[model samples]
Target: MNDFFSTTILIATVASGIRLATPFLLASLGEALGQRSGVLNLGVDGVMLMGAFVAYFVVLKTGNPLIGAAAGILLGMVFGLVYAFITVNLHAEQGVSGIGIYLFGLGMSDLLFQKLVGTPLPIMPFPEIHIPLLADIPIIGPMLFTHSLIVYVAFLLVPAFTLLLNSTTYGMNIRAVGENPAAVDSLGVSVTKVRYSAIIIGNGLAGLAGAALAIELGIFQHNLTNSMGFIAIALVYFGAWRPFGVMAGSLIFGMVAAIVLQGKTLGIIPRSASDLAAMAPAVITIFALVLVANRFKQPAALSKPYERGR
Candidate 1:
C-alpha cells in the first residue's frame, strides 16, 4: 500500500511538473527564435518581471484577466522595442545591452510596484479553463487540461515554434541571418531588420511568461521568478536551440520543482531538503550544458550587430 501510494504521488508530481514548466518552455522558445535570428536578448528576466507586475495591476484595475493578458503582450512588445533600440539600432554589444535592459526592467518594475500598489496588498490571479472531455481524465485531467488559458497557449507554442522555424519563409530569412549575416546582407535582406523583429517577438514572449507567473500563481512579489528567467535562458542551450528540445528540458525542470515543493508538503521530504531540491533544476542545467557544450553550435552572428557601411 505504501509503495503504491508513493508511486501515485510520483506520477502526480511528474504531471504537475509539465504544468509548471509551461512558462519556461514558452519563454525559452521565444528566446530560441531570437537567437536563431542572430539576436540574443538577455533582458528576458526584466521583461518577464515587468510583464508580471503590469499584467497583475491591469487585472486588478479592470476586473478582467483577459485585459491583464493583453497588458502583458503590450508590455512585452515594448520591452522588445527597447531591446531593439539599444542593440539593433545602436550597434551595441548584444550581451552587455541585454544586461542593461534587465537592470532597467527590474528597477522599473520595483518602482512601479512601489508607486502603484505600495507593497501592501496582494494582486489578483487568473482563472482556469477546464477542457470538456480531457479535463475529466483520472490523474492527467486536472494536471494538464484544467489550467489557465495561458498554460494551454504555452503547450501549443512548442509545435507552433517548430513549424515556424522549419517551414516558414521568414524563418528561412532568420536562419540565413544567423548562419551568415553577410550572405543575407548580400541578398538585400536587412539583417538588422530580421534581428530586430526576432528580439521584439522574443521579448514579448518573455513578458507573457512573467505575467503567467504573477497572475496565474496569484502573487506579484518582487523577483517573483526567483531566477527562473535565467534558467529559461539556459534551458534554450540545453535544448540545443530547438523548441521541442526546450519543451522537454523545461518539463524536466518543472517536474523537479513540483516534486520538491510537493514533497515538503506531503512530509515525504523535510522542508530543508525541499529547499535544497529547488537547486536541482539549476544543477541539472549546468550538467546538461557541460555534457552537450561540445555538440552545440550557436548562431554565427548571435552576439554581433549588423552595421551597414554608408
Candidate 2:
C-alpha cells in the first residue's frame, strides 16, 4: 500500500509539472518556428509581455477570453511585422534591433498597464476540457487529456510544426531562405517575403503563448512573463532548432520549475534551494547551446546585413 501510494504521488507530481510547463512549451515552439526560418528573434520577451497585458485587459473589459486571445495574436502580428520590416527588409542587425524591440515592449507594456489598470487587474481563467472518452481512463487519461485547450494546442504543435518543416513547399522556402537567402533570391523566391512571413507567424504564435499565460493563470501583473521570453529563446538553441526538440526541452524546463516550487511548498526541499533549482533550466540551456553550437551550422545570412547593389 505504501509503495502504491508513493507511485501515485510521483505520477501526480509529474502531471503537475507538465501543466506548469505548458506556457513555455508554447512560447518555445513559436520561437523554434522563427529560428528554423533563419530569423533569430530575441524580442520574444517583449512580444510576450505585450500579449499578457493585452489579453488581461481585453478579458477584463469584454468578459471574453477568446477575444482577448485574438487581440493578443493580432498585436503580436503587428509587432512581428515591425521586427521583419527592420531586420529582414532593411537588413538591420537582428540582435541589436531585437534588443531595441525588447526595451520598447518592456516600457510600453508597463506604462500601458499602469495607465489603464493601475497596480494589477483580475483575469478570467480558461475552462479545462476533458475528452469524453479519454477523460474516463484510469491514470493516464486524467494526466494527459484533461487540460485547457491551450495545453492540447501546445502538444499538437509538436507534430504539426514537424510536419510543416519537413513535408511542405513553404517549409522548403523557409529552409532555403534561412540556409542561403542569396541563393533563394537568385531563384526569385523573394528572400525578404519568406523571412517576413516566418517572423510574423512566429511572433503571432508567441502572442497566443502570452495570452495563454495570462488567461490560464487568472491574473495580471507587470512583467508577468518573468523572463520567460529569454528562457524560450534559450530553448530554441537548446532544442537544436527542432520543433519536437523544443517541446521536449520546454517540458523539461516547465517540469523543473513546477517541481522546485512544489517541493518548496511541501517542505520536501529547502526553500532556499528552490531558487537555485529554478535556475536549472537556464543553466542546462547554456550547456545545451554550447553543444549545439559545436555541432550545428547556423544560417548563412543570419544576423548579417543585406544590401542590394554596389
Candidate 3:
C-alpha cells in the first residue's frame, strides 16, 4: 500500500499504462472509422497477429523499427483488401466472414513464425524518444513524454481521427453512408467506395497496432496479441464509437492492466488469483460497454451489405 503511493511507483505505473494502451488506441481508432462507414471488422485481432509477426520479422532481419512499422501497415492493407472483397464486393455476411479472416490470420501467422524463426527470439525493441524539455519535468515528463515514437503517434491520431470523422467532407460521407447509404448514394457519393476505404483504414490501423505491440515487447511468439484485438473491438462499443471516447476507454483499460501487472510483481496480488487479476481490464471494459450501450447509437447500416438497387 505504501509503495503504491510512492512517487516513483505512481509514475512507473502511469507510464506503463500509457505504453500498453498504444495498440488498443490505434486499433480502436481504425475500428471506429469502419463502423462509422457502416462496416464492422471482427477480424482485427487476426489482422493484428499477422502484423505482429511481420513487424517482428522485419525488425529481426533489417534492424529498423520504422521499416517494420511500415511493413506492418502494408500487410494490414493487404488483409484489408481481402476483407473488403469478401464483405464489400461479395456481399457476404459480415460477421461470419470476419470470423473466417480471424482464423486464417491466426493459423497463418503461427505457421509462418514456426517455419521461419523456429524459436521465439527477442530482438532490440523500439528506442524511447524522449521529448527534450518536457521529459525533464519532475513527474509529468516521464509519465507523458518518455515513451517510444509509436505512443505519441497513437495519441496524435486520436485528434486527427476526430477531425477526419467530424470536420471533414470525407468524414461526412462516412457518417451519411452508415446512416443511410441509399441517401448518400442518391447524393452522388459512392457507398462501396466509402465502406471499402473505411475497412481498409481500420484493418491497416490494426496492423500498425500489432507492430507497435511487438516492437515494444521486443519479441514474437504464438498468439502475441493475446486477444488485444478483441479488446479493441469492445473498446469501440465502450467509447460509443467516438474517438475521444475510445481513447478514454483505452486509457482506463491500460491503467488497470498496468496496475494488475505491478500488483503481481509487488506481491500485492496473490499468484493464485492471477487469472482473475488478468480479467480486470476485460471485466471493466464490459461494464463500461453496458453503461454506454444505453447512451449511444450504432451506425444504422453496420454489418449490412449494400447493393445498387437494394
TM-scores, all candidates, are 0.93, 0.92, 0.98
Q: Rate the local accuracy (lDDT) of all candidates.
A: 0.82, 0.80, 0.92
TM-score winner among the candidates? 3
lDDT tens digits, residue span 193-213, model 1: 888788888888898898888
Error of 3 at 29 (Å): 0.8
For lDDT, the strongest prediction is 3
Q: Candidate 3: lDDT over CA atoms?
A: 0.92
* Runs off by more than 4 Å, candidate 2: 1-8, 291-293, 308-310
Off by over 4 Å in 1: 1-12
Each model's total of backbone clashes: 0, 0, 0
Ranking by TM-score: 3, 1, 2
Model 3: per-residue lDDT, tens digit, 111-219?
9999999888887788998999999999999999999999999999999999998999999999999899999999899898998898898899999999998999999
C-alpha lDDT (0 to 100) for residue 114 of candidate 1: 83
Higher-scoring candidate on TM-score, 1 or 3: 3
